[model samples]
Target chain A: MFLFMKQHEFVPQVPYGTRDFLPREASQKRAVEGALAQLFANWGYDEVVTPTIEYLETMTVGVGNDLDQHMFKFFDKNNRILALRPDMTTPMARVAATRFKGSPSPMKLFYITNVFRYEQAQAGRQCEFYQAGVEIMGASEPAADAEVIALAVESMLKSGLQKFQIGLGQVDFINGIMEQSELSLVQRQQIKHAMVTRDLVGLGEILVKSGLSQSDQTLLKHIPLLHGREDMLKQAYSMVTNDKSRRALDNLANIYHLLENYGVSQYVDFDLGIIRDFEYYTGMVFEGYTPGLGFPICGGGRYDTMLNSFGMNCGATGFALGIERVLLALERQGIDGTQNCKGIYIGWNKENLVKAIKQADTLRDSGCSVELAVIPESCAQAKESQKSKGYEKLVYVE
Target chain B: MTSSDMDYLTIALPKGKLFAPSAEMLAKVGCTAEDLSENSRKLVITNEKEKLHFIITKTADLPTYIEYGAADIGIIGKDVLLEEEKDLYELLDLRFGLCRMMVAVPEALKREKLSDYAHMRVATKYPRIAESYFHSMGIQMEFIKLNGSIELAPMVGLAEIIVDLVETGRTLKANNLLEVATIQPVTARFIANRVSFKLKFDRINRITEELRTLLEGVVTL
Candidate 1:
């Protein structure tokens, strides 16, 4: 036996940046997905599934060349390039444009699936992660953006997260402010890079070197810091002179008012410098951050141009919550939970095992969780099994 | 966490050169510590009576700490912030620890124009910044990522030129390199977590105002 073990050694290992979930963790993850799926249904979103593989070029069309290298891609049997999707939004947009033509004006779809990326793994982050999100297509009003946010807030609250806030902003507004600047293309890119990276020092040097007036420099400098109440919008309103800036501010103000009407205002805050995914995102973009988590647990925004790239002209907005990040928040708050089942175990002696099986079927048919166990050799073993298996009740039959 | 941990406003400061000036600025806002640099082994420096705490971390990790809300505030350099690209509020430019990100070459290869090196081989820590800069100019280059001893890359023939931070030009001069172009100027900046800024508005605003006034005073002096 020792010689056989030495000759044919079995090594168990998964790929780096991937994870294997034990029983308890898998159950908890399912619970989180179930809750999100139910909420998506409640909000009039039907479930949809896209193929896990797609043509690499189609998936990489707007996902940026920087992110292209991170996607997991392989060659198909037909010598065609196929890549595992790094996100659901692009595939969903492709489907909405091609498959569902002439069916409905607005299509609401939700997915709970795994997306893979080639990134260094960290706590609450993985190369392969699960996402629960919805896509609302053909709606361009502030109402659509607010509804997406309302659903996100509701989903987070339902998942037992207490301390989380969403930073709301319009990408166009930042673009509008930059358009007002007379800085050359190179200088403007430098300044925008600084602001997006939250580098005040770099931003200031470029603004000063541009030789702008004190007020314009101040406005551009403070754009990243201008986040808060109605007054922040008022402050931004007083600064710009361009029409796009004016319209962007008005759109933001309208979205804010609409979110207030959605009754999720407490979970919403405004920021003028939310530049994440801004190039792909046209109007409203937001990020969800919970206390004590360095990365955003949820992020999405309005992408009017994405579907157009897929041969459709529909406006859409949606957000995806990271399943593992939500679970981390839950675990941090000590909220590891199962599917909330109360089961009764029916135990019987060997002579009456058939009777116990009948009883178990009766209980299960009547909407009760039932676990059946043949009588153990000792009472202690029977009781121990019942306790460990979370049986609410144990019935001993002769 | 202890009761003190719950109530105190936390600030994360970079551990090396930036800590002294950041601690000095925080001191002006009535947040001080007796042992900021006294013990290198310790991570957290605090003044419980003032409800202020500071976490010492690598410059690269400062944005992560602040973004995750582990610390309510952070003071870091523009280079680290740009490299990290975390979501946070840039409250003010504290304006110390200034330096320049420069594209440099060996002094022997100095007089040629940038276009002369059509196939530029560059080595530095800031690959993302360099990639974007070169991509904008339609220039082709090979990039190498190095953590330290970037000055050795050019001498060893690994890269023809290097993009690195130049503080006093002493290191560049010693390494037989000359600065060709400046990418951007960098300085220390005060930053806040976006969520914390809203939840702890009054204290954050008060501290920011105090630091701004103090910094203005320093400039005039």
Candidate 2:
């Protein structure tokens, strides 16, 4: 007998930033994605697909230096460098520019895809995760922008989210501040770094060192403190005398008015300070959040010039919801995205083994989830001739 | 969902201009917070009848608190809401503490024809908001992140433009900077932690509804 010499048996382990979803988790994810897909479709956003891998250059540019460093880069068989998409937006942008160039304007595209980013895994953040979102191309109107925010709210509500908030801000507002400041790039970065880390003393000292006048220092010191609701807009509006600052305020006012008209003002709030992850968004940007999660559930903004890099410039605003984060939120809230599951658990017996198998099939065919006993007769008999497997409504046939 | 068991509704109050006013509002709502205003100490105060507890935190941390369920409700500026982008139900407008986030550039760079610097170096505390604005204008620029002293980035030639929150243009005028754009106007709000809103619906809703009525009166003035 030829005993085929054994090959090396190695312990199984998943690659870092990857996971194997068990049955329960997998089923739950599928159910959540299905509900999200239905919601997206209801908004007339058709699903689209993009490659998970792309040439390094196409995905690298405009992805930002910080993100560029994190991309999982490797070489193909031909030795050409490639990267797993760190975000869906870049891939979607490529698709829009190259493939759907002539298709139409205002293309409402939705996608359920995995994006890879190398970061330390924490509470709601995974190195590799799924995102379900829509990118509305070819429009920059406040109404269209408002539509994205509204759809996000509705999608979350459909995902069984009862309590959440959306923070809206205008990118131009900060740009107006920068346009009026004399701070250097490095100084500006240091200041932002301090503010993001909540270093009030550091922020105060930086303003003083920037050589800003006493009045400028006072005003700059208050930047970290500005935030909250509508009337704050008026306070913010009062600060800017120049037409540029006034225009940015006006843009925010218009958006607020539009959101009010959409009947979503209740769920919406304003934050003039929210600088997002992307380096590309220009006009209005926003993020959605829930209390249970440590990070934003979704985020996007008006990347008007993102397409310009692809040689097509059009005003656009959109947001993306992290499916995994949303799922985690739903779980925390105890709202099952899907509740349908099998109730039948089959018991084993030496004489009834065939019958159990046939019965399991029958139950499954009838749209019931059934678990068949896999143990042999000895173990099965020792436990019980038949066991209900903890089902509240257990059935056994002799 | 009945949530009568969760009695004390925790609140995150951003400490600043909105801090005092929000504390007063909480007092008016019967939520005591004397310890919050005390200096040189970390204190968390709770009011039994009001069924509210207050956590004094950074303006930016208010949303984080609400977002993380650490605080059932929070008081924050509209500007922080715009920047941090947390998901909380803005239950009411506190009608105080207002500001503006703006785009500015050195006076010399201001007239250089924004299009001329295709690759403009921009500095701002609000990078996401700044990037979105320039993106809409079809302008591409490198973002230099600064927490404070955004004005310095322009003066030192690190970036030509700046984006920071502005309450008054006196600073810009003093710095010889010009405003190019305004991202959004700001304010303070009564934001609800999502789960708290759901679990303590009746209590939180009652308090917010009352505060809403009071603010409606203020807004008219």
Candidate 3:
């Protein structure tokens, strides 16, 4: 026999920070997304799909230019730049502002889609990832915020995550503190940046330099540490004297009571320092965390000002759950999220092909998953195929 | 996993100088583990009764462990945190292992300012910190990454300047290098994984409160 070898063996590789989900993972992801989509629909939210790419300026209007570096941008035919949507909320906001502006007062929209960001690849995170999220526009009350927070907890449960907590924070809490302080605008930004990054050392350094009173400095430094149950909220209320800060506390307390009505109060903690990275978040913010993952698996907040950029001038609140993160959390917690059902495999002798096909169709029509073999095989061979393919049962026709 | 195993609090400790003091501090909070010495070959030590696990890791890898939630908490140098840029809660300053990250030059070159040598070759183990510092100062320089013996780079013509941590000026003095600029103060800091900080809040808060009281006592004394 002549040896026939190719000159070069091809090796397949995915692009940096991207991945291909093989069968098992793909099925699990699909199952989770389906569950979330169904749940969102059940909650009275309509599904809205947007284009994968949009004008760079449109994305900047929602997320700001800080995230411009992370976006995947390219030139269009007219030399205008277009970017892969870094987040679905911005695109969802765009759709709401332009398409659904005059339709109604409150438009509840949900999306299950991939968002692109150039980030350092890690477990439970990637450059191109999937997010299942919902946005409620035009409702500015604490109820809207509470509904999204409660829905976020429900989304985690729907994804089969049992142990997780939602850290609820109001940006206005800190904003109120900064408003009352005599520090300059630059100082406020620096302090907020430190708090957002959870850099307590940097925060202390800035507070020391800020000319606020000793008690004010102590109160500002204590904002991040003010996290716990309802009692912590009561304690925080006593710590700040500013009306804005007190109002923020009241907002959190109001949202907490609503969460109790939703029966998700046990899952939330008052994290007064949770100024999310997104500058668009102008109101209450929250992040969902499970034990196994280092990062927040889901996060969102109220951004009442984002729609004004699109000229709609509506208030909005929403949350997004990282699909991969939910799956990873499920795996780590030893919970199987994928319901793989291998119903039956049908095989046949040379003349039994038609019969086998009929049997498969019958089983399928009866709501059982069935796979029919293409070529003829012995009963033993058919059994082997059935066993190897993980089918629960086999039907042999001779 | 046993119910007790589920409650086990894992802590990542850096190897070398900070190891002893870190373990001692943990002991004060009643989280003592066997085989936790720096000289021990075991990477992991456990206190089964107390439900605590201590992982001995390289100084740079400490944050990686905590950030991935492999370890719920860690004690690491601020310099490494600055370089690694991992997302973690800087819980408390441990107030020990103090040092300063300094940009140094060979005495013979006699450069007083970083801008004086605009296009010079700078060597460092911390490329990220050095690059950002240089960029902030609008100075462009080639970088030579060295693992150890950073002072030797400037002495042997490998690089004109070096950026490294200085606990004392003794090493630079022996190597005939002069400190040019101080980047920032370095200290061992207590850090926690973001998820663990919430999930194990009560346990972590107890230890943090204890340590805070201890540190406050030290400060007042």
| Candidate that would win on lDDT | 3
Write the residue-wise lDDT of candidate 3 on A123-200 in tens digits.
Answer: 888999999999999999999999999999999999998888899999998888888878899999899889878888
Quote each prediction's TM-score. Answer: 0.82, 0.63, 0.96
**Cα-based lDDT at residue A343, candidate 2:** 71
**Tens digits of per-residue lDDT for model 2 on A124-206?**
66788999988888887877788888888888888788878887787677666656788788887876665444444456667
Report the alpha-carbon TM-score of model 1 versus the true structure.
0.82
**DockQ score, prediction 2:** 0.06
Give Cα distance to truth, residue A144, candidate 2, Å.
Answer: 1.7
The DockQ values of the predictions, listed in order, are 0.30, 0.06, 0.53
TM-score of chain A of each: 0.91, 0.86, 0.96
True contacts kept of each: 0.38, 0.10, 0.59
Q: Per-residue lDDT of A1-398 in model 1, one digit per residue for the tens? A: 35546555786668888998886788889888988899999999999999988899988875767668888989999999999898988888888988998768789999999998888687777889899999899999888888899899998988878778888888888788778767778887787787766656568778888887888888887776667877888888888888887788888788888888888888887877777743578888888877656567798899998888887888989889999999887876666566555578777766787877888888889998888885542456667777888888887766
